[model samples]
Target: MTATLIVIGHGMVGHRLVDALRELDRDRRWRVVVLGEEREPAYDRVRLSAYLGGRSRAELSLVAPEFAADPRIDVRSGTPAVHVDRRARTVRTADGDVLRYDALVLATGSRPFVPPVPGRELGNCFVQRTLEDADALRAAVRPGRPAVVVGGGLLGLEAAQGLQLLGMQPHLVEAAPHLMPAQLDVEAAHILQHGADRLGLHLHCGTTVTAVHAGPHGAARSVTLSDGTVLDTDLVVFAAGVRPRDDLPVAPALRLGDRGGYLTDVLCRTSDAHVWAVGECAAVLGRCHGLVAPGYRMAQSVARQLTGRPSEPLDAMDTSTELKLLGVHVATFGRTPGEDGSAIEMTFREGVSRYAKVFLRRDTGALLGGILAGETGSRADLAARVGRPPATDLERVLFPDPSF
Candidate 1:
């Protein structure tokens, strides 16, 4: 008898788990059911902004062509899991169907945060997260119209660039003091700010959006900043942040983090042994890492255990991220600043062409973390050195010998 397993999401991380299980579970010991809330199957959400750059829906799809054809896999798109009967090990769907499962995996991912400001519900106000959100933003863009994008992080910067590509006058609003504050140091952020200015993006840092004003026609007209400046805009896009989608029925029974993600053990198991959680919805060791890499590792760990393979605990994870925002290359691998006080920090810069910083153990010279801006060509090589002691001549790597 094959065990029944139900997965509550079909996003990138969820699909990873399914693919891993399918590859390793050659015995066909388990039957899988995937329930996706979106009508469309999983797609490359990381490249969602590319849609504005002429990429189509089909190009962003992450679903394999043979996935739906698998006899052991049952994919129900547009179906959302509404409630979980933990006692009965069953889930109730939106269509009044109850699914019994020997094991349950919650991969619900997250929802983009829209601030509760006045006039937020007005027309042309959007949040960038899913393909649907991207479509809405694309339709809302009016060439030569003014637009304000909330937040200066990666997503917000990407939105601003996308808006610019659509021929809109894009302005970035960041409550923090600098762009990519969490990833880049003050100096690195300064370089990025310069790049944004070159791209013709308006920057409004250190101010929060207090409220959005709407016109009599119910469309967004302007936004009021905390600094008492009113930015006149035809549209507003909020890329502020995201919170895990933990509103399902199973949410109440699971232990959640202070910030609202399902608390799971290293094995990705919730309080219930039969129930597991992964991706953005899961918080391991009380910390929820929103990056895709960590989420992908979590999916692999859970899949290994379910397939009766040697499962290792999710111990240390690399939270590094390398990407180009607004066409400006940026990479933050390892911790920006080492937590230990005994770390030596080095910096290098050259005429806006590059900015690099490295942190090493003061005594052992082990690489801790680093940041690169405008020059990420060595991102892959440097990122691989994180958490490991430097094996090569560190001086030559940061500053190549003139003789060589």
Candidate 2:
């Protein structure tokens, strides 16, 4: 019998799931319901900063209009699921619309983590996670306005750059000792910090914001740090971190993680048998994979399992990620600093215009991770080649002396 598939959180990963299930089972009889809180179709969250930097709303569409309107998919945007009837296998929406599903996929994704601080509720304080949020931020941006982005990670840096484009001098603040602390080492972070300095941004590392002061119009005007240093800024964009949006529609005994994602099995199944959770809200193998790939994997696995077909176990990923921060390229791949293994690596660069770093397995001579700030793009291939037979050309590149 064709089962009813209801997936909550219709963002990028969720919409991809709708497409994946259709391709996997083309019978057109299975009911596909995508419930979303946002009022628009699934769009790219990675490019939210780009949108804030003046890209039109139409540019970020992951699924085209015609495809999204296909008869097979029922996408309900702007209406969020509020309650879950575990016993009846029904999900209730905010409008009290109840849906019964044979298999429910919770793609409830994550939200920006705003640490509880004074004046967080101020008007100009914002979190850049959705297109609506981006639009709101764009509307908030004005000429010569001082802005502070309270995180130095990818999204935070992106937000800082976007704010610069909006004519704001953005101050990037991180409680960590360095920028991209989760991804880059101290050396790489220094290079990135230098790059940010060159981009007309002010940097604040190893400092915590103690309080936020509001202006007369009810917007944030300044931030006081733990060390008593104050930064005067009209806006505060908090990109510190994200937490899973798993607040609604859950039964008893279903526990949330320390980091706030819903706990799930390797196959994306939650503690409940009839339901599953995917995307940023799921903790897989004790990891809350905030990236999109794993979320898509979870979606695919659950869909296949419901169809009685065996799904392939995903290879443990060593994702090599890169981004052009302002004008400088920053990258990291495989095991980062202190990731339970020692690194054998090499570094080279002539000047500010050139740089490279390669990490290898200490004893096995295997390429573990690499960073090329001003040079080439071999990290993706390196990640793909990991744990697989080295391709001929890549092997030659990694080990030119093939005779050995």
Candidate 3:
């Protein structure tokens, strides 16, 4: 029997599943229908901030024409899934139509988190999730305008830099004591802070926005800081973070995970055998991975299962991170140095800013955590260095022969 596969939200993971399905079959037994809530094609959400800076809309596309016209795939745009009826194996659309599916996959993805504070409802205020948001942000940041971005995390900084390119004096505000508290240690964050400061970007660490007051026309006029200072600005971006989107109603057949995600088993299958959930909307093996790589893996897993092939369980992944910041390479991984580690080796060249440090369990040869700055040219190599054995020899493993 031909399987009717319905995938919701054609973002990163949704698109990957479409690709995996095409690879599995040349025949037409499997029917793939993708419902994209957005009005346009699936573009890279990871690069949306770069789009605000200078990248064209076209550069963000993942699956272009040839993939779109595939015989087995039918993509429906501007269609939002309002509710899911699990027992009946049907999904209701905002247009009041119901579509039946033999197997359903929910890849609704996450949305930028905007905390409720005064003036948050202003017209010019925004979050950078869709292309429309990017367009509005670019318009708000006109020549010589001032802007403040709440949250100094990766996306927050990226959005801040975008405004900088548009001739805006960008101020980054973070409630945390250091930038990227979830990703970087205090020392590494200091290096990033210094670098950003050198770029003339004003950073307000350990502060919060008390209110955003707007002009009578409803555009953001100025942001009032918690410390009783107000910065006059035109653009106000909120890039605090993203959480799985699950506000819509779901059919009883779809089992939502603990704390609101769609629950999926090792194979990415939901409570019902015929239904599966992946991407930001899923809680896999007790952890929610936001990066694209793991979501891509889940897409591959489901395709293999449908094609009657062998696939591996989505195993535990280290919640580490590495990304470009104003052209600097910043990476963080493993445990923090002070926690559960016996000894920590810190290396720094005084004149130069290169830094490397690693922690080893006091009694054993196991690797606890490590951080690399400056010579971060080896961020990937260092992250991959954590494995079953204590690095063969910490220094030797840190710097291996390039020839090997």
Candidate 4:
């Protein structure tokens, strides 16, 4: 008899798990059921900003037509799994349907975090997370009007650029002292800010949004900053951060990590042996990965275990990142500088548009971590070189010839 595997939450990672199972389950050992809360099918959320750039909903879809037509796979869009009966090994949906499963997986992903400031519930305030959120932002776009984007991380910067593409004057508000404080060092952030300035993007760093004041019609008219300054705006887009969606009702409450998310063992199994968790919702080894690559790896790990294959743990997952924000290329990889100041740090810069920094261990000269701003021609090569010594001369690694 074929067993049933019920997957809750149909985001990118959930879809990936189903796809992996389909490829590995050659004997058709298990039937799969996917529950998606959103009405729309799985789409490329990483390229969600492309929606503002004139990409249609169909263009960003990640679901293959053949996968949808698979008889063994059943995908229920717009259906949210409300509760889990661990003892009975069943799932309850919002539509009053109960699903029995031999094994269960939670891939609920996360929800965008909006700070608890006054007037945050105003009419024009939004969060950039799902395709629906993107559609809402696009519908509210008014060219030539001022818009405020909170947070200076990757998502915040991307939202600012998207607003600019929609012909809106975007003012980025970051509580951090500089942009991308978590990823880039001060010098690298300076170079990135210079590039953003050249693009006519307004940045308000070292401050927070105290409150948002409403207009006569009750929409967001202006915002008060922590520095006692108020700026007029048309809308507010909060791309601050995200929290795992781990509040699903379960008979025996699942273990959670210190920060947040379902605490999973090395094999991505939750407290329950029959249950598994993946993606942003699974804090494997008590740590949650926000990047897509790590999430994809976790999904694959779960699928491998279900198919009776050798499953690999996510202990060595790479956390490196590279992206272009406000037309400036930036990348960061490997371990950052240690707090004790043991790692040797080297930096190079030419003009305001370029900067690079690399950290190396004093004893072995092995690469520890590095940051790049402006020209990221060596991102791929340098990221691969992480944890190992440079293949060529140190100077060449830091400052490659532009002619090449």
lDDT of 4 at 306: 95
Q: On residues 138-189, what C-alpha lDDT tens digit does candidate 4 reach at each position? A: 9999999999999998889999999999999999999999998888888899
**Mind giving the per-residue lDDT tens digits that candidate 2 earns over 168-225?**
9998889999988777776677777777778888998998888899888888989998
**Best candidate, lDDT:** 4
- Better-scoring candidate (lDDT), 3 or 4: 4
lDDT of 1 by residue, 43-76 (tens): 8888877887679999999878788788999989
Question: What's the TM for model 4?
Answer: 0.97
TM-score of each: 0.95, 0.90, 0.90, 0.97
Once fitted onto the true fold, the runs of candidate 2 whose alpha carbons sit more than 4 angstroms away are 337-341, 387-404
Per-candidate local distance difference test: 0.86, 0.78, 0.78, 0.90
Candidate 2 vs candidate 4: which has greater TM-score? 4
- Report the lDDT of model 3 for residue 98: 88
Q: Where does model 4 exceed 4 Å of error? A: none
Which residue segments of model 1 deviate by more than 4 Å? Answer: 338-340, 387-404
Residue pairs in collision within model 1: none
